[model samples]
Each structure stands twice: as C-alpha cells, then as structure tokens.
Target: MTQEPAEVFAAFRHAESLVARRRPLDALVALAPVLAAEPDAPSVHLLAGRAYLNSAQLLRAEDAFRRVLELDPSDHYARFALGKTLQRQSRLTEAQTQLRMAVAMNPLPEYQEALGEVSARIAVEGGR
Candidate 1:
C-alpha cells in the first residue's frame, strides 16, 4: 500500500521516539511501513539500524547500517553503528576496520572509544 510522504515522516518520527525510549521491538514495528515507503532514505535506514542494534538483532542491524553507508558513504554514524554490530557478533577485525573509518571521518569521542575497545579486544585475542 502506498502512503503519503507526511504519513511516512510521521511513522519515522514515531519509530525514532520508540527507539530512543528503549522500545526497539516497537520501533521496528513502527518502522516497517516507513522502510517499505522509503527504502532509499539513509535516515530511515539509520533509524532502523539503531532499533535493530538495540534489540540485539545484530545481522539485521549490520544490514541496515550497510544500506545507510551504501546510500551515503560519508555517514560516520553508520560506520560506527556497523562497527558496533560487528563487534557484538565477535567479528572484531571487520569491526575494527569500520570503526577506524568512522573515527577518521568524524573523530567523535564515542567513536574513538569504540575503536579503542575493538582494537584492545583484537590485541588480546591475537595474543592467545
């Protein structure tokens, strides 16, 4: 079913609020129609990715984050989110690469901290 742009925007905002309130599952439900309506919107995908990540749906989170990057390569937040999803899945090397790019692009303290964490994990695991 097709939806009006205003409706999609409203759903997106509602979904964003749900995610912020820690109701990720609810956010995902609210996002479904928005995703269907605006599959190419980086903001929508980023919001879905955050919901997925919050809900521990790591693979889906990774996919959503990847989609955001595909739409806009310079999205440092997407890179950081992808890194975090990979890190949670124990894919430290891949996570490290994404985190490095994120930090390089924006140098946010959170990005730096996440990169440091993944790097430390890799170092510890490599020493084994």
Candidate 2:
C-alpha cells in the first residue's frame, strides 16, 4: 500500500500538533499511518522520537532518534534528542558525547544547553 507524500506530511503535521498539545499517545496513534508508509523517513522518526520522549518512553525515543542518525548522521536535531533521551535515562556519559556532537554540528542554543546539562550531570555523578 503506497501513500502519497503529501498525505504522509499531513499526518506528520497532525502528529506534531498532538505532541505539542501534550497528547503523546494520541500523537503516536496519529503517526501510525505515516510511520508505516515512511518507515525510513528521518522526519517521521524524529517526530515519533519526540512523542516518545515526551511520554517518558526513553528506550523507544532513543531508538527513533538513533534511526534518524543512521539515516542521516549529520542530523543535529536527532543527535540533540538522542542526547536528551540518554540524559533522561541517566546515561550521562553517552548523553554528553551525543550532545557535544550535536552542538559541534549545529551550535544551536538548545543543543549547547543540553550539552552543558549533560556535562554537569556527568561531573556530579562521576564524583570528580
């Protein structure tokens, strides 16, 4: 079953709206068709990752973000999201590495902030 690109993009927008409204499960549900139709699409995976992250599904979010990186290694947003997911899971070292890479790639304020936060967590948790 093939879906039109426009339809897939529309679903993505709908899912984003659902996520922004804090209805993660609903977002996931809304994204189902897009996910099925565009399994390898980085934007679809990124949106799913965000919904999962907002819902505290850390592992799922991590996988989705990783999938985006696997598809496009230069995707700084995916790196930042992966870093945040790892941070939420208390994998501070991994988070720090990803966040650093994201900041180096894009130098966005959010990426830098996440990197700083992850580094602080490592510092505190490492007892150094």
Candidate 3:
C-alpha cells in the first residue's frame, strides 16, 4: 500500500526535530526512509543535507544538496547549503560560484553575507 503524503511529511518533520535536538544520527536515520521514497522532495533533501553537514559528513551533505538542486534548480536554500559545504571542504572557487548563484536567486542578506565571506576567503587564498 502507498503511504500517505501526510505520513511522509510527518516523518520529515520528526527528522527535523531530531536535528534541532542535535541528534544528527537520529535525524539521518529518521530521514533516510522518507528520502528514499521521496527523492524529489527538495525540503527533505535540504534537511537531510543539513543533518549530514551537522554530522560532518561532507560528501553525504554535498550529495543531498545536489539532489535538492537537481529537483529544483532555483532552490536558494539548496544552493546556499551546497556553497557552505563546498566552502567547508576548502573548495573555495566552487563554493564561491554556488554562493553567487544563491545570491542572484534570492539576494537575501544571509546569502549576501555568505557570498562575501566566501569571496574574501577565495581572495585571501589566491594571495597566498
């Protein structure tokens, strides 16, 4: 039998609650099934990416963020998360590109801040 969308959404929310409670492992475990069933859900991918990031699983975080972008190219949150993940991995140039795209998409102050920070890091790295 097919599960209801509401059930999937509830599970996603519970995963988010786990992340909020700083139980990233639990969050990941809770989210895995939902993600497998709803791979195209951008919000689910975004939350999973965040949980992975918080757990320092950079590659998994990157994969989750990439899935979000693939499902919805215009998702600023996904772009931002991807950028942050890249930046943490020291892929400054790639991170900057993603950050720029995110800023162009939304122009939110937070995006601007992240873009500026990444740009500065790139510039500083280039100088070294």
TM-score of each: 0.97, 0.92, 0.91
Q: List the residue pairs that clash in candidate 1.
A: none
The ten-residue window of minimal lDDT in model 3 covers: 119-128
Off by over 4 Å in 1: none
Question: CA RMSD for every model?
Answer: 1.4, 1.8, 1.9
Scored against the true structure, residue 48 in model 2 reaches a CA lDDT of 96
lDDT of all predictions: 0.95, 0.92, 0.90
The residue ranges of model 3 lying beyond 4 angstroms of the native Cα positions read 1-4
Would you list the rank order by lDDT, best first? 1, 2, 3
| Candidate 1, poorest ten consecutive residues by summed lDDT | 119-128
Q: What lDDT tens digits, residue by residue, belong to model 3 across residues 1-128?
A: 56688988888999999999999999999997798789778888899999999999999999999998999998998999999999999898899899999999999999999999988987777612
Clashes of each: 0, 0, 0
Clashes of 1: 0
TM accuracy, model 3: 0.91
Please tell me which predicted candidate would have the highest TM-score against the true structure: 1
Tens-digit per-residue lDDT, 92-124, candidate 2: 888888999999999999898888887877777
**Candidate 1 lDDT tens digits, 17-111:** 99999999999999999999988999999999999999999999999999999999999999999999999999999999999999999999999
